[model samples]
Target: MAFEMFPTVNKCESIGREKHTVVADMDGTLLIGRSSFPYFALIAFEAGGVLRLFFYVLASPMAALLYYFISESAGIQVLIFAAMAGMKLSSIESVARAVLPKFYAGDLHPETWRVFSSCGRRCVLTANPRVMVEPFLKEFLGADMILGTEIGSYKGRATGLVCKDGVLVGKKKADALKKAFGEEPPEIGLGDRQTDAPFMALCKEGYIVAQNPEVKAVTSEKLPKPIIFHDGRLVQKPTPLMALLIILWIPIGFPLACLRIAAGSLLPMSMVYHAFWALGVRVKVKGTPPPPVRSNSSGVLFICSHRTLLDPIFLSTALRRPIPAVTYSVSRLSEIISPIKTVRLSRDRATDASMIKKLLQQGDLAICPEGTTCREPFLLRFSALFAELTDELVPVAMVNRMSMFHGTTARGWKGMDPFYFFMNPSPAYEVTFLNKLPKELTCGSGNRSSHDVANYIQRVIAATLSYECTSFTRKDKYRALAGNDGTVVEKKHAHLKANKLMGC
Candidate 1:
């Protein structure tokens, strides 16, 4: 759906040149509480055809009664509570892990994704415990830093207690942010509750009140502009809403069905395939080459490029068996309902190696590997974490273009851009599954390290796509270049697209 509230930002204008930061509230701001929480419970309950929800439902009343008694009683209640709490943290986590998938799949607001696509550095400031929200954050929300309550750990299990000074809320949140970023921090903040009022007021550009009316009334005068959510959606005008809804919900299934029949196992990735078709972009498969040799019994490591924000969406729609995408610490904040598994990658050495190794052992490991998105042909250098994987690397190339009606730079490529994609008409994009590179090529042939494998992979990407090879180096520098006229170029492209669609 189109979110009209997000105003268009001109990259060529004065405001686009400035660096903007985003401070977003977790929980209700990014998540639809009852909808997501219970859905996860449902998914976990059904995994492996086991009715976990049936058990949880049967246990909830008793659990609730037990919890109630524990909360009220003085002597025996305390002992009972202590006994229940004694259950290992691992047990609770395991239960949560199983139940989370049901609630989280595709529950995120496109506006939030559009916001992330539109801004620069983003931080999540919340009162919720980090462990309770980590998977949602890591998989979809795209938060760079998780500012929340730190829970106690004993013998590697959660002690079911929050650390004394770690709760991130009220003045404490401001203190935590200042401590981490020093006196200066992000310029924009978003939230839906009164508790977030303080943090949102800290933004130089101001704040966006997410969903509640009561919170908005209180913060309206003291904070930056507050954004409110209505009808389970961002409160945007009607015209744009009609436009986006019309485009996204149109009937384009026949072609998708045809493509699926031809592709077989590859058909489930219909979302990716149909998006290009919807834009009338044609894919001329050169020829059906024999499948590449399978790697050492380990598994497949699907290392792909990040061409547009839709790449993963298409992958999720097409690739069967929940393919988890590896992302930076940032994406976790917005990816609340991501349908599959997601692994967080950190720059910290020990953590990075551990994550890479574990991902290789699981099913296919899907990674952008580029670290950042690029519209140009040259790929950003790949992180060395790829070399740690035991599986063979399958290089996937994503091909896309600026549609005539919709002309704008790609989202999340890098930089502090406030680009809202859903507000405008969307362009067409495509993902092509290319040949896989052997472990030797990805690991290094001879003395070449993983960086060499990265180089070879980048080269293959450049050869297969139509992007400008040198454009990757330009980065945000192009926003000021005299010859770079994105608006004019966009209009011309839009006109061309309209003509092509009409055969005029």
Candidate 2:
């Protein structure tokens, strides 16, 4: 029986026919939200590092032009495949096989897969190259037949050429269906895009699995609601504008940041609040109201969760006090321009400790023991030095969320990260201050090791953010990103990813 939204085709009378088949488009319909083809290159590039990915990413623009001016999306796909030419087919197959299990379990759409499995014969008619999806279609989907574009290969390597059949697109797709299932139309069909319309015309029962209800409203207004399915997944397709949008927010950032620093440093604390709020950075504070940062008191030490380079800046904005900060890697020049006093650590334990002790003696001081900017919720092991220095520990938990630009980074010139963060229309921060650690919790008479005090602070911050507590450290992340060995002679750079294309 056909899904009710679709008209029961005349072919229902022949339901028991040996080839009673249901066909679906691969990219958006049967598979997950995105097209299945281009990911083939990503799989291939796992063996080749950032350079290989960089080369493909560079060619994407020409591919985009071809999409608009010449053929449809098929042209862009061919360009992508062409770049993979000479790549070992085994490399492609290996990554696909390794990840297919997880992809099917996670990324594949749940609702559509059910409708797909309910059909008699599972045939995915797609413009994606057959070899790319064939392994999974056979191993995972139990596909009876695949109508897809074919790639030419020689001696276990891609040749970067589409076979003589050309891209399986538009009218070509409709003709291919007729060639296989005879001149008679299909009994059941499903598709997501207008490009899927040609073959849909041949279906006895056709359904549009639209992501946007408005699209279905305007296009299939007269069509019955149930047959016009909506699984509520965003359609993910390659777009030229993504790279452009990421960068448009960058140009004016530096100037605005200079103004932010100058204003925050010179103006009254209340005006400092207005200055950042004007730039659309809302700082939300919670928990009990603490005592004043500046007082007749001798000294105060602030221990905070490491989020971005601007953690202290955001903290400074929240507390209305520019506490001098001690850091491991930040340069002295960067600190000079900052609104707050910053102590750059020399990475020498004794020297750095002396500097921190002296700074604390002079006035209030702040430090992020995690030692690095971590974009993820999990944190690195906290340095125990902060715990050893002061019993008056002020645990500050801060997090920043941005839509247009991410402010945190592991590499590249992070000096501009705050500017990039402020570039967003509405950059936001959630800051929480736990009650100052009591004598027992703070490395006091119970004679707690600095390690114990550090772990306690880590737990408090992790619980506040609802982030997973992990033993992973900056060294682990550094090795992953830069292939850093124990010695820092010259860390080999990893393969450039799509996200890394825009500066960190």
Candidate 3:
């Protein structure tokens, strides 16, 4: 059926991927001192419920028994439910309000801090009631809301009855999030117990921090991702591994494995290329809309402006549809470090012609016609690839807000390493799609030359992108406006001045 459902529309579309919360367990989690069992139970007891004090009273023995027979399960989870079952709603709220904070102090997981800083909002989901956990969260973590099992009460006295049918666990926690926040839940979820496994599943993305082997096993096979904890504050990126693999493979197998991987345009090799610049690289997009798959209707040969040592990657990531790219033969060294599929254009006429024919047949080709990256408003001469291809020429103009030194055009930029040009931490690139040229403009009769076609395409692209498009002689058709006083005075103002002087 190909049907898919998510907590929210934003989640369904990936717009809210970065704005979700991590729903985590407290106690053995974010805290390291005395367990919060006594406090949690006291609150539940006051709320008029059966106190399951066996976990608190006999925690060591019980944990030992489980470790020997079954597994070292989440010790905090057992005690929490016991506390809830034993309390009256009113009494538990009072104890929770008073004692939750004292136990919250400790070194929190570094992954949690990253989520807090990066995501839109962060939240805590625990079996403890809001009155007990709310104050600590607000004072320390500044959580948006708490989703926990609620106990009912009346007047000022104890109800002596568990109001909710069941404690929030597994499927119930997912229900709780949906009930509180509606169907569109947060992007991240975090928890410490097997009970929270279902709730974490409801979130679009987040991590599950398994404190012990038992909890890890409980959720291990069930969760979509492999459980990982924060080693420190920043997650260690896998770039170094990729770099090492490529460097090591060069000697072991020589160039054969690298050549095959590159020629096949395998996705894994593409990922390796990305890892090369992982330090400087960051994901960027205009929006997450699927790229246009139709034939190139808006054509001028897409002469994209190049910048950042990873311009090819930027094009691949930013443009919705895949683009054919033209590259210099010397730049092929990148195949060893990162596999990029490109049309190899040679300065030789026969070789260039064959490559151009292949690119035109492929439909969308990203031609860096300028041959090299340059400063804004200045562009270099168009390469002959433009002259050879007879298609709608669309100028794909790029204005680089930042420079990456690890690119093909950068000084000292050998093709061995990956350097990225990010607009910022979040890539905000400007990709202006210039208007396409009409076919008749270049197809006029017998004597039309490739240079003539190249010049015309060049001027249109220059005028469209507002770059100073010049020719081999360095004199553009627009040179008169480019501070050339002799040309401007002689070509433009001479007729006006002569008529005025003669009083005609």
Candidate 2 lDDT over residue span 363-394, tens digit each: 77889987865554555567888788778788
The model with the greatest lDDT is 2
CA lDDT of 123 in candidate 2? 83
Tens digits of lDDT, candidate 3, 1-504? 001221211222324436455555554444321244445433432233222333334343453355346642334344444455434444454444333333242234444444443545656666555556775565446577777655555565433333463445567767877886687767666555555567767766545443442321122222111111101000111122322332343344324333433432445433533532453334343323323435644322466665433455456555533565676643455654443456666678787767776556656566776665543354456665565556455555565443211122222334533322221222334555655555555543435566666666566556656755433222321232122313222212433442332222
How well does candidate 3 score on lDDT at residue 287? 24
2 versus 3: better TM-score goes to:
2
All candidates: TM-score: 0.36, 0.58, 0.34
Among all windows of 10 consecutive residues in model 1, the one with the lowest summed lDDT is 225-234
lDDT of each: 0.45, 0.62, 0.45
Ranking by TM-score: 2, 1, 3
Best model number under TM-score:
2
Give the 10-residue window scoring lowest on summed lDDT in candidate 3.
Answer: 227-236
Which stretches in model 3 have alpha-carbon errors above 4 Å?
A: 1-301, 329-333, 337-339, 403-410, 416-428, 444-448, 472-504
Error of 2 at 400 (Å): 1.1
